[model samples]
Target: AQSVTQPDIHITVSEGASLELRCNYSYGATPYLFWYVQSPGQGLQLLLKYFSGDTLVQGIKGFEAEFKRSQSSFNLRKPSVHWSDAAEYFCAVKLVRGSTLGRLYFGRGTQLTVWP
Candidate 1:
């Protein structure tokens, strides 16, 4: 079965600092990877995804991730952070199947607290 694990349950950062969040997955073959961020009481916004091709993929909100097949990792990184970036982040994997768009299995989530 496919699954994801996010080691950090919560993280805190100061405004204007850099940030990185870890994500690891277990799958038989190459899996679709994604990172999403959710503000308080809001739906998740896609940060980035790794479907195929290049190991490094970029996404909205100045976020990027590198897919490491060897490590079974896809970690999200931001060069610098903003106060508004404070939110809950989730790492997800889309199940690989023949027909349907498979369901996404998400990590428990990491709560990010930004200090002024």
Candidate 2:
């Protein structure tokens, strides 16, 4: 079964600090990787995605993710943290070939706290 794992359920960082949310997936073949941010009382927003071609993909809001096939990981990173950046981050994976194609398998989610 394909699944996404986010090791840290909650992380706290000071404003202007660097942020990294770990994500790992389990799949036979390389599947699509995505990072989504869900602010309080808001819907999920696409932060970045890795479909193919590039190992490192840039996303919205100064976010980026590197796809490492050897580790089956697609971790999201940011150079600086902002108060507004505090939100719940979720890592998702989608299979290319299967009955569940196009269905996103999401991680449990990581709650980020930014302190000023």
Candidate 3:
């Protein structure tokens, strides 16, 4: 069916190191995909999204994602990760049932730990 998968449960990185979080989705149609980050004891923050055109989408907090339709993936990337970037990252996709109303289906998040 339609779902999102984050293969890595947790990842550790050094401060100023590059980071990449894998995201995969299965959908029949052109999917509305999003990446979000949640800091500890805080609400989720929208990172980036992909609907159509220009596979590469820029997002806040120096984050970006490339949507690969051929591979059915939207992998998140950061050139360099800061210690403050330590948080839980989630991959999500919108699904519409019946009418135009849509709901989000999220993948199990990837926890990033940044060490000095």
Candidate 4:
């Protein structure tokens, strides 16, 4: 079964600090990776994704992610943290092929707190 794992359940960072949210997936083959942010009482917003092409993909809001096949990891990073960036981050995977093609699997989610 394919699944995504976010090691940190909650993270607290001071404003202007660097941020890194870890994401790891378990699948037989490489799967499409996605990072989504959900604000309080809001729907999920796409932050970034990694399907193919470059190993490092830039996303909205100064966010970026690197896909490492050898590590089975697609970790999200930002040089600086903002209070507005505080939200629940979820790591997801989508199957491009096989019987469950296009099926999306999500991680438990990581809650972020930014202190000013």
Q: What is the C-alpha RMSD of each candidate to the true structure, in Å?
A: 1.4, 1.8, 1.9, 1.8
Please give, for residues 1-116, the per-residue lDDT of candidate 3 as tens digits: 66789999999999999999999988887678899999999999999988778999999999999998888899999999999999999999886634468988999999999999
Model 3 segments more than 4 A misplaced: 97-100
Tens-digit lDDT track for model 2 on 1-116?
66899999999999999999999999999988889999999999999988889899999999999999999999999999999999999999988745554789999999999999
| TM-scores for candidates 1 onward, in order | 0.93, 0.94, 0.94, 0.94
Give the range of the ten consecutive residues with the poorest summed lDDT in model 1: 94-103
Query: Per-residue lDDT of 71-114 in model 1, one digit per residue for the tens?
Result: 99999999889999999999998876444668888999999998
Pairs that collide, model 4: none
- State how far residue 102 of model 3 sits from its true place (Å): 0.7
> For candidate 1, what is the lDDT?
0.91
Clashing pairs counted in every model = 0, 0, 0, 0
For candidate 1, report its TM-score: 0.93
Q: Give lDDT: candidate 3, residue 46.
A: 96
**What lDDT does the true structure give each of the candidates?**
0.91, 0.94, 0.92, 0.94
Q: Which stretches of candidate 1 lie over 4 Å from their true place?
A: 97-99
Model 4 stretches astray by more than 4 angstroms: 97-101
Question: Residue 87 of model 2: what lDDT?
Answer: 99
